[model samples]
Target: MSMDFKIENVLSMNGGQTDSSYARNSCYQEISLRILQPYLEESIGQMKMVPCGRFCIADLGCAAGPNTLHVAQIICRAVQKKYKALGIGMPDLQVFFSDLPCNDFNLLFQSLPLSVPPDGRLQACHYFAAGVAGSFHNRLFPRSSLHFIHSSFSLHWLSRVPPEVENQMSSSWNGDRVYISKEGRVEVAEAYLRQFQEDLKSFLRARAEEVVEGGWMFLFFSGRAGACPRQQGGSGAVGDILELAFKDMVCEGVIERATRDSFNLPFFSPSALEVRELVEEDGSFLVKKMEFLSMDTEMKIQSDVDFGRMVAKQFRAILEVLIASYFGEHVVESLFQRFAERASQNASVLYNSLRQGGGILAIIERACTP
Candidate 1:
């Protein structure tokens, strides 16, 4: 089903550090960040600073949480380390935390550590910080103004669901599923792939204008191991489970069957080859390093119920707003409750699936001028 892709109005993580907030349930995201840290440091070491003794870094899709500023701190320290090794004065850092205006920038900023000395005496690095609210698919910064860009687990979100998927008469119509799955039609999967391609091209074009020549971008997103959507596995286990929950709601008459049929998720997981080809096709960035890495959960679950609840919370933190916006706020808790029950019952299988799951990390550099 199709809905308005009004990201600024509908998309955001569950805010604050409350029990269900993204900040508390983002352990998996934190794990991904750690996996990418080494790559970030290496990229910083190779960066050619923009003139005038300043460095600008933007973390796109920086949802509200400890992970938001956590990225900034890692980046600042890496740049600092590079400068120290070169025996040069470190440039003033300007960090931008960007996301849709609906993001909880208030909580993100409030959680930032107290100011440290500008001289790098009290910490590894220190600099200015600000928030920019807008879709990264559009131009968000001045032309050639940024030195580095980082977007984690954000690129998978399409600008909107493909229009064809919403038209009931269209061959690409995605009926009864929130995302692509093993049972999905070939035409529907192709529609999603095409949308991802267009959205990715827009993202590259915008960043090409904003980032300085020779700047770097380190990106991470959920992806399939194979080139096509249906290969490897399918959309994802979590997405499948979520769909079943919606089905259960429909069976119980809580939501009409048409309602379930009309709500499609605006997300796509591309393969690494797909990402590389898209970047090369755009003719801006040179792919530096591309690899797949798995995110291991830190929590030790004592039982199936605990594991199920943990998984449910993670999805809720990231997806509650999007789901609630389409299905109504009252249905949100009940949906996740159904989700938890199913997940707990299949805990062992889910755990094994998660252990085998991984994502793509693409480190690309803005090609230098001739």
Candidate 2:
């Protein structure tokens, strides 16, 4: 499908703790970094021991702020420390923070703190942050320019929602909220799989060009476990809870059933095997390491009261945005208020249901050919 990515619209809410902060502290970051540290160490070892030369690092899908830079900083320091232990001077590094055009670059720039030492020893650090503004499948940087590329909590977003699904009027009416029945689940899964294939091809091609040989790229995203047709008990609980919540909205006539089915959330959690296959399929990159960790969404709640409040708050926050986008901004508050009442009651049941429905974190690195 020829998809025009509305970068600005998608990132309209990408600020504050909700956007960058939440991701910063997410388990995905913690897990992915653990996998990344060694590869970074090895890469630093291979590079010429230049004491004052510039090294390049890029964060793809950097979003709008310091969160990306913060992660980059951590990586840089770790690499520098590794070199310092070898009695090597620090290399001057150029860090690039890239995202879609619609991202709030002004906010990111404003939030960026100065990176100089008090004594002005020229910390050997220079930053070049910009909005790539186009799909990652397309050209974003020069070939072989990047040493390390990183992205997290993205990649599942298709270049566009499947055009066939978008074009099919009947497809839209297939679900109430996010619930996909046996057949509906199969169809939707196929569509998502197709989207992933297409997007991954483009993404791999683009990165293969930008990343230098032996350089690494780390990606952390959400995906499902096992090959289950219908989301049910077990690891499917989050899907179930979201399905139930959407059904409540449908029953209340808050959203068209068609919209729910036709517009699936732009995310997927691939199995570790599935990820390995993707990495191998590209043939340009080799799978260095892949590990899956169970991440419970329920961990957001510390207490019963907090759980209740979080359920209501998350529902309202998401619903307000959805209602405002599809309906009118005027009805957003009212719609969310009504949804919050129902969400509070459902929170306990949903929390229990999803007690085991955590997420997965995967890290892939670029392989160096002999």
Candidate 3:
């Protein structure tokens, strides 16, 4: 792994059902999933057949939260609809929720409904659920295992920050910034792009070996609408505002400049073109639907305060553990509080940036051959 960020050891969403946990803050993810419903149903409808007796579905990077089960439930519903429309019985489902080993499977499983409902109302479709702990960058299942695979708001996270970005001796060194920014060096962006390409290539290769031919894969993750990663502000705006927060702490001597410089997040938001090129290069999957979606525009922010708090809480749920690991838990709450205040002041700009740095939904079908 590059730097101190290890995919298996360091990456995981904030667990539990607390006010600050990922479960509460994942409304944004739910919106993305809602947007995905039509396409998911379409994919299922197009699939004229599924495995004979049991259908295996895996939700990769299924972080701890209701969203995790929400994704599975959506797929099960779609599958049920498809079977009902075909006038055939739906196959038994073996759903796997896969995430990093550090994830809270306990919370995820506990969130499942009672096995035997007191109301005696049976679920429309029953699924045998299991949690698979591992990184999706590698193979998590046996050969030709998964019949349908879905991942939402994941995949942009690299297995690690590019090694060169952390080396002061390297030209790509990203000093005092967590991600690629307008003020950052082009070499730094190039480093991130290379890492993203490498990680994506590995991801496709692994999934190719695991998914059966003709199975479907749906992926939704952050992306840039522009052709060039440097052309638009996308996720860079978040990095910029976050750097501002860190600078505030630095000025107060709460953290050293070197401490901030040494820290970097393992994230990259790719362009739609970049994703298509990578998928075509991999040659294992045929793109069925690939489009850039603006998730922020769909959100209804009543006021600047609400927008600020929403953005701050959304990011805190994702970055709280990583930031606390690097900067200590003492500063976590104050840092995010300052972030919310700063975000409120720049609500308009932040909204536009987030819209530009929207999400990408790609529905691809496994080809007959790699």
Q: By TM-score, who's the top model here?
A: 1
Query: Per-residue lDDT for 253 in model 2?
Result: 79
Q: Would you estimate the TM-scores of all the predictions?
A: 0.94, 0.76, 0.93
Q: TM-score of the candidate numbered 2?
A: 0.76
* Candidate 1 structure quality by residue, lDDT tens digits, 226-334: 7668543423677678888899999999999987887787888888888889999998999988876666545589999988898899889988998888878999899
CA lDDT scores, all candidates in order = 0.83, 0.56, 0.83
How large is the C-alpha RMSD of every model relative to the true structure?
2.1, 4.7, 2.5
Runs in model 3 deviating more than 4 A are 1-5, 87-89, 114-123, 231-234, 296-303
Q: TM-score order of candidates, best first?
A: 1, 3, 2
Clashes of 2: 9
Put down candidate 2 lDDT per residue, 114-135, tens digits, no spaces: 5666664545334444445656
Report residue 296 deviation for candidate 2 (angstroms): 4.8
What is the per-residue lDDT of model 3 for residues 121-153, given as tens digits with 9 covering 90 to 100? Answer: 446766888989998899899999888999888
Under the 3 Å rule for N, CA and C atoms, how many clashes does model 3 have?
Answer: 0
Model 1 lowest lDDT segment of ten: 227-236
